[model samples]
Target: MFALSGCAQQASSPGADAPSGEEPAMPDNGDCPVIDSRDWKAWVNAMPGPGAETTLIVEGAVDMPTPGYTFSWEAGMADRSAVPAQRLHLTATAPDGMVTQVITTENVRYEGPAIAKEYRAAAVMCGDELLAEITDVVTAE
Candidate 1:
């Protein structure tokens, strides 16, 4: 005759939470500056008025200020070496032919792009507080 032993164990309640293991780690992005365009494209819309101001709008913006429309791997993607320093200088000529310049500060950098669900979009103003004019608009991918 053989004898067997049995023991009963308690079960956890339905409300009890399960033990969670370690979470996955984020990929390493080295400190080196990456000046890639992230495959973003751009378009331009300019409405110049005879005596009035121009209207400008941009989309698909790269962060740190990479403004564009949609994504264009050909036109947008760039290696860190290919990334150019940002320039927003605007030059305007008045009716009298006097050339005036809107010196935009070098606020845009090549660190990376500012991508979100909708990309980057904005309406740029070139004039002063009372009257702002937008002559050129750049939208990107």
Candidate 2:
């Protein structure tokens, strides 16, 4: 005889055909898996799928002042020579109501074995007022 529950099986004899001690397995619906914090950069780099035509890449790291907060961003452009200039801006707000901005502008003058580009001065503005501005440039081959 076959019994569904343990108590019901006890009422029957040991000769019952039902298996003992093991329960039926349930189906698993995989929704979201956890990502390790250390692998975050790898995850971000893999966002654009295989079919992306034009690529825009931005990458930077942000340092936290104290206690508990941090921010980082990255981006990339596949065809750097296509556009004369490309502008990017990053804004962040801290828990204490402080605001920060990072701006970058790339200017292409010539194209050879190596590429030269300039990043216009970046501005850190708080609220409606500009706090600090600095000029920096980067080149990539």
Candidate 3:
């Protein structure tokens, strides 16, 4: 359940699982159940699980404008960091199969007046391993 933070915190997006204005769960030692709208800077160093395996998780939040829409997401590795992969990839794909993969962490936002009927954003760690996805329909325009 991802919610908007800093902006658009008052309105709930379509198909949202959590209510707006609700506070995100406090991070216990920089770990959270889901990477929602909360303080995530410390999440980078959090090794939430056991074993040498690493996992990448992406959490997305959407906002509706008059004739268009905007999406924002964040990526985190809630496990061991010293995995074999040197790079992490976060990809966004539309219903029409338009895929965008960002190697750096800053390209997590997607906005347009209807790129497709729906969008699926994913976080892939260690190259070929798929970790998580967040999908929802675009309600604006």
TM-score to native of every candidate shown: 0.20, 0.25, 0.19
What global local distance difference test value does model 2 have? 0.29
Error of 1 at 22 (Å): 2.9
Score candidate 1 by TM-score against the native: 0.20
Q: State the displacement of the C-alpha of residue 84, model 3, in Å, after optimal TM-score superposition.
A: 32
| Regions of model 2 farther than 4 Å from truth | 1-50, 67-82, 96-141
Query: With candidate 2 superimposed using the best TM-score fit, by how many Å does residue 136's alpha carbon deviate from the native?
Result: 12
Looking at model 2, report the run of 10 residues with the lowest lDDT sum.
34-43
Root-mean-square deviation (CA) per prediction: 20.5, 20.9, 20.4
Ranking the candidates on TM-score from highest down gives 2, 1, 3
Model 2 TM-score? 0.25
- Model 1 CA lDDT for position 70: 22
* Residues 31-124 of candidate 2: C-alpha lDDT, one tens digit per residue: 1111111111100122345753333233333332332232322222223543223333333323455434322221111111211233333233
Question: Model 2: how large is the Cα RMSD against the reference?
Answer: 20.9
